[model samples]
Target: MSLRTLMLICALALPAWAHAAAPKPLYRDPVMDGAADVSIVFDKGRREWVMFYTNRRATQKDPDPADVAWVHATPIGMATSKDGLAWRYGGLAKFPAQCTGQTLWAPELYQEGGVYHMWLTVVPGVFHRWGEPGATARIVHLTSKDLKAWACGDTPDLGSDRVIDASVAKVGDRYRLWYKDERRGSRIVAVESPDLVHWRPLGDGPVVDMAAEGPKVFRFKDRWWMVADAWKGLIVLRSDDAKTWTLQESRLLEQPGRQPTDTAKGQHPDVVVNGGRAFLYYFVHQSNEPQAKADPYYGQRTVIQVAEIKEDGGVLSVDREAPVEQGLVAPK
Candidate 1:
């Protein structure tokens, strides 16, 4: 069947989504929701790719537990793809039973020194809570040699009220982190570490005027560039030192009329440069369902997509198949 035909059949077969949201079509296959933002990486040995994101609910069974309270319970989940097209859900990448199943939000996975490391915004309970204040929010992470045996690692303290949405990139021998620093009043900040274990702030922040959340950094065509999702669909910025950045573009890759709350919220993008293709992975909400009188974020799920960039500066953008409501795409 053709891709559109397959999608039509898939839509026909899909159940009436209960919440107030519908998932926007992002990547092909492995239905992408609006809550799970993805990061992609290539596996040379396996000849495939991997994507990591926040899981939220487990298998849609037992529900979110927070359904009673109407909040987002985001745990970490993963997905894998062979040709960057068809994907399969791997489910629950790594969770700490200690957090009591609370949530692992905004995770960024990167291969550092032949090892795969993932860091996420972690909370303290088995269920989800909102507006918990700063002191409780911390960045949780994991490190693995094989990507299969994902062992929980140290929790880095960036801020308390809102320590969330972390992005990692390797610049030379050192690996740098671009994350939201709540202490600085919700701005995109950069920090560097010789060892991924201990990180120190590089100084103030990369963006001072705007609420710079979900900062993703990568080098395209020899120049360092950054992507973030705030009020629009994937904002772009560039910096020579990872400190001072200039806005290149905002809402550049848009899927119009998707979400009521965020009409152009195709943000939280992470890019992986492989074979001259910089796959910029991002997520958004599809608001096409009946409005709920109760929870506003109820229909909110994650949809993963990619915008390709070439070494010679060619931009290629494509939306993949949607994931099962909040289902994640793991690594192959």
Candidate 2:
């Protein structure tokens, strides 16, 4: 072939690469044998991405099956990443006296008025068993100027006793808190506050009809999006007024084929939107591969992971199989 023709063919073959390299999304926490229910936020003061999750005590054995062991009380886990793809364990998050030794579940984080706000699920006593008929839990709010030293002792119980997995967002002049109130159903409900302190119900009904938990809300593409954990997978909803929501046909992170450890479904996701792009963060159960005679890392473990989110025809989706390499753009 002529030199000019050869050059032309090569350029045409790799045209896309010339513009931008393909994304290779690779991020998973290996430090802890058990890490689940992940939330990621960019700290401007620290200039790093921080991930908070349930730092499960993997060594403590459960009388129940290992599959259900994540239910036990765990200190909130913390990890930081320079870029979105790779992460290092930072250690367990320190809570104030009120939260000390308290079993924590999903952590919802937000920053406003130069202060960091965290809404966490608190179980006062032993987490003998998950969904124990008489077990009670509540959502508490704590604020810190810096994430490290939290002013914790006070318990601002945001109403119902059986509520958990709080996801809050500031909308215009008020803050809206969405959580799963188990007493009503496993369905998610909403309460709004003008100052993030005193909260009142937005309506008398569940935001979602399905039995779901861990509802996370964020604004993207001039609209608000909410993704909730339904135990089966993630259910997506979109809202214009932030009060009334319409369910979308798509369910995200339901399959396990593309992930490194394709053993269990992705649960309790927190979506971070930065620089006009969205990313989904969640944790997967460690694989059930039998441990060999020599290998010790085998068996069940949970690790945090992230995947780039895509939007099509006003619907959002995440590809667990696609490689995501670029760091998430920090929110302005």
Candidate 3:
């Protein structure tokens, strides 16, 4: 081969390695922007993608602090589409009765033994304004043997404090539940449950703790990836044994957005693998306000987005396309 030929080959390969190509956004939920905490469910039977999330009638830190208890949030909302690209809002799903105005948050729906199991943040006091000091936020899960009639079962007590945004993933035979509890600093903690209701603490209660919140997990390259948001930025940690994990980088990815409407402060890192490609769906809260002021991290409320997840062994960031999508969160 000629030296010139070799030089030409090197030049052609430069673009592929120059900077990893960003993944494409498949869908962005309008509700969380008005929509919050969106989850994506792929209906294999119908070959469709179902999007579910919380449609807040008002935010936690609304203009009126009293609205926190008064503004009745629309119950857990749902939308469906043939592809993840198009979504038609399906309105609210079943809300836990007796908990008025408690439009469910963190409605994570996953298939368990041919049934759909949903675990969500149930702030009962906010719904009723009971003013129950510690009984503010809780993680209550339910199961639907047929996706129709549901039954609430005994789950773990996230402490009466404020615990929300629960993400559960099945790693082989055991179940892993990740949630944010300021009860222990705004970090993600993991709990193990054999029956999916009762849980056992794995690794001193929190397997991964950061100055962040909203933890979700996805499996790729035959390994478990734990994604969480912290003051530093959005980080990804990998685990093979389910209990012990490794942080790929202190800062795995960062979303730069300057405006209140643009993608900033990425949270709720959700990933969807489709058509031999992977999409990372992250919730971007407009970072215009102090990070503390931002409910989830430091933005406006929370908006759902879809992004492409790059698989290059140890590094990945969101590839935002126009009208960018952060990725998939059946529990988003």
Candidate 4:
């Protein structure tokens, strides 16, 4: 072949390498800097991936000693990505004020029947401290046609007013929703629904008998996996039947990575399985960094990260230091 033709062929094959690796801190909320509890969904209409996260006011200054309002009265922030590697900050989601409250936390998204559904943790009003009188969190269901202009829907009664961080997955013919029940020692619990509206408790008690929050359940590598933020590290569990789960011996993202803004333990994971590959998107606080030492409030700042999940012999693991090579494949 001629040298000119050979060079043209090589350039054509370079498209894969043309896309950059996933950034160290995949994304950060431009406004608040407290992006947590990410829920990633593919926007079929827009042909991109959308990330919804908790936008905590981590930059708040001169707050009262007892005031926890920085974490409260937050909105669900949005970010969009064309290839799931490079993301841009989209504005906050718009939920009907009449249906939602001042405080919004973890948002879980599921799509069916050409409609998008979100299960959001809502606290009626901002509070001065945690567990203040009448301070309660509940999950509310909302539906949107275009991922904007959400309309209120039914609220599944999981028999708890102190529930948050919802994770939903379809198992068999029914949909299973897993969330943290703070009233039950912050243990992860679940409820099932044939449709998205009505719900019933899944089993006798907590699915994974551990004090964890931000439960994320998904099917990957021919097995059902559940990962939750256990404050120390992410607890991993595997199940043949999405109902009964076996806890893995090792935790993920437990130790700090050498990357910037990822020195602390990862929290609040959201998993996306595409084309037989799974990618984990989690948030990490900068609490252990020198910046936190200079400013006490710097510890409150958090950023989103992406890592490829690996499974071998029925065991799951993630190397946060490795570059993420898998880009999300558009839904068929």
Candidate 5:
């Protein structure tokens, strides 16, 4: 082949190379610097990637050591990115106070028929500590035509009052929602919905029999996968049929990474599969670092990070040490 022709062919193939290096510590909440539980969706009208995350009040000055208020009374924060590398803070999401109350976490977003649907973890009121009397968590449904303003919908009966951290994906012709059931040993469970309104338990028991939270389910490599924060590291599970899941031997983001603001374990992930490649977006704390050890409050801060997910012989792996290639292509 002629040199010019060969070069032209190579140049044209560049778009097909789906993997690229993404920015380390991809995003942080500019307001409170406590971004977590990310849900990424492509805004078709705006033609950009939008991240909806929990905006914890980590910047509160000199919080009481015993007080857990910093984690409550949070708003769902938003950020936008054109290429999923450089992100711009977009502030908190707007929801009617009557329906959503003061605390929101783990914004799980799904789009169907041009409407955006969110299954958000809502706390009735702020509390100073965990497990305080009358503290309850429930998942509420909301719908939006544009990503900005949301209208409240029904809160599905998930058989638990302390349910939180929702992850939704369409399985076959039905939609499946998975979340943490804290009342049940903090295990992960599933519920199915036909029209995104009513829901019922997928089976008699939890999908993941381990103590985990922030379960995210996605399809990649022609198989269904679930990744959940197990407090130690993110656990991986695979399934040929989205309904029956088997645990993978290894976990992801369990070990610390050698990056600024990413020295701790990854938590509450959002996986985006684009252009035949899968990327895992997760949040990391600074608690294990030197600075955080000196100042305990520094550990409250968290940052979002992204890494490419690779599969070989049906095993999924991530190299946190390697620079992530930016491979987020716009969805059609």
Candidate 6:
């Protein structure tokens, strides 16, 4: 072939090379190998994506009781990525000594007033199974300037004995927090604060119906969106006033074509919106489902996944089976 024709052929093959070289659709914790209840925030100072999650011990098999082991004490897992998809485990978060070895649940990361704030669910008594009579859970506020070197604060009393999965968002001049009140049938409820220290209940009823947890709220476009883990799938709600909400008819996490067979429901979703593009981040347990049983690390182990959120005729949807690239891509 002539040199010019060869150059054209090479140019034609470039697209094929790019297509075949697309990054694999997977993200996992290399250290503990168990990542759940994931939350992501951009680190502008570090110029990368930082993920904080529940770092469960994947290799720790359940003892005779089975229930207690799964709920054992854990630290908040940390990972960093240049792009949001491929991750490198940065190790567990280093909190105050009091929080060491305590079961740290969903971590809600928010930045305000030049400080990085984290609302973490702290559960006492690791030996007791979840929902045990003596086990107590609370949400504590933490602050870090660099997402490292955290300062712990007292747990805010939300008029509940058992609360977990705290998510917060700032609207106008006030801050709003939504969390699961286990004292009230594990339903998701909301409270507001002007300074994020003292919170008052929004109303007498739960913001979301019973049987859901991990309430996350974010502002995208012109409306506010809230998502909760409903055990079966993710329950979605939208609000214009940030108080009254209407549930979306379709559940997000129960789509049938999930890879690795998401037998268990997707829990604790944190939505990251950038430049009018939204990406939903959540984790799925690697159960003994048909697609996961073949892997040696099945059961108890969980991996994080991200999906692009799209709106069609005012309805939002995600295809869990769609491949995610290594770097974050915002929709045009």
lDDT of candidates 1 onward, in order? 0.60, 0.74, 0.62, 0.90, 0.88, 0.77
For candidate 1, lDDT tens digit of each residue in 1-332? 79999988878786443221223344422433434667666554566677677654422423454442222455556677655555677666655465324655777777755777778677555433444433356777787776667677877756445577888877778878878866666778877888887888877544646776778888877678777766555667776766677775434555653434334346677777654445656665544334423544535544665545433343333343223232222333
Locate the minimum summed-lDDT window of 10 residues in model 3.
17-26
For all the candidates, what are their Cα RMSDs to the real structure?
8.7, 5.0, 8.1, 1.8, 3.1, 3.8
Q: Which is better, 4 or 5, measured by TM-score?
A: 4
Clashing pairs in 6: none
Task: Write the residue-wise lDDT of candidate 5 on 58-177 in tens digits.
Answer: 877544777878889899999998778778999779997777888898999999899999999999888988778888899999999889988989989999899999999988789999
lDDT of 3 by residue, 1-332 (tens): 99999989988886332433223222334544446566677655555576777665533455544334432344676777654554666656764474323446767778755677777777653453433445556777777654445777665765536777788887778898888876786667778778787787766756665556667787777777877767456777888866687876645346555433444655656666655566666655555546535454223355565656776766665545444333232322
Candidate 2 residues lying further than 4 Å off, grouped into runs, are 1-31, 63-70, 99-101, 153-157, 287-300
Error of 5 at 318 (Å): 0.7
The better-scoring model by lDDT among 5 and 6 is 5
Task: Give the Cα error of residue 176 in candidate 6, in Å.
Answer: 0.2
Q: Predictions ranked by TM-score, top down?
A: 4, 5, 6, 2, 3, 1
Tens digit of per-residue lDDT, candidate 6, span 232-323:
88888889978888899998977434445354567678888875678888877777456455654456777777777777755678777666
TM-score against truth, every candidate: 0.72, 0.85, 0.73, 0.95, 0.92, 0.87
Runs with alpha carbons beyond 4 Å of true place in candidate 4: 1-9, 16-18, 63-66
For model 3, state the Cα shift of residue 93 in Å.
0.9
> Considering lDDT, where higher is better, how would the candidates rank from best to worst?
4, 5, 6, 2, 3, 1
Tens digits of lDDT, candidate 2, 242-317: 9999998878877764534644577788888877788887767655333422343343466666677888887988
- The residue ranges of model 5 lying beyond 4 angstroms of the native Cα positions read 1-20
TM-score of 1: 0.72
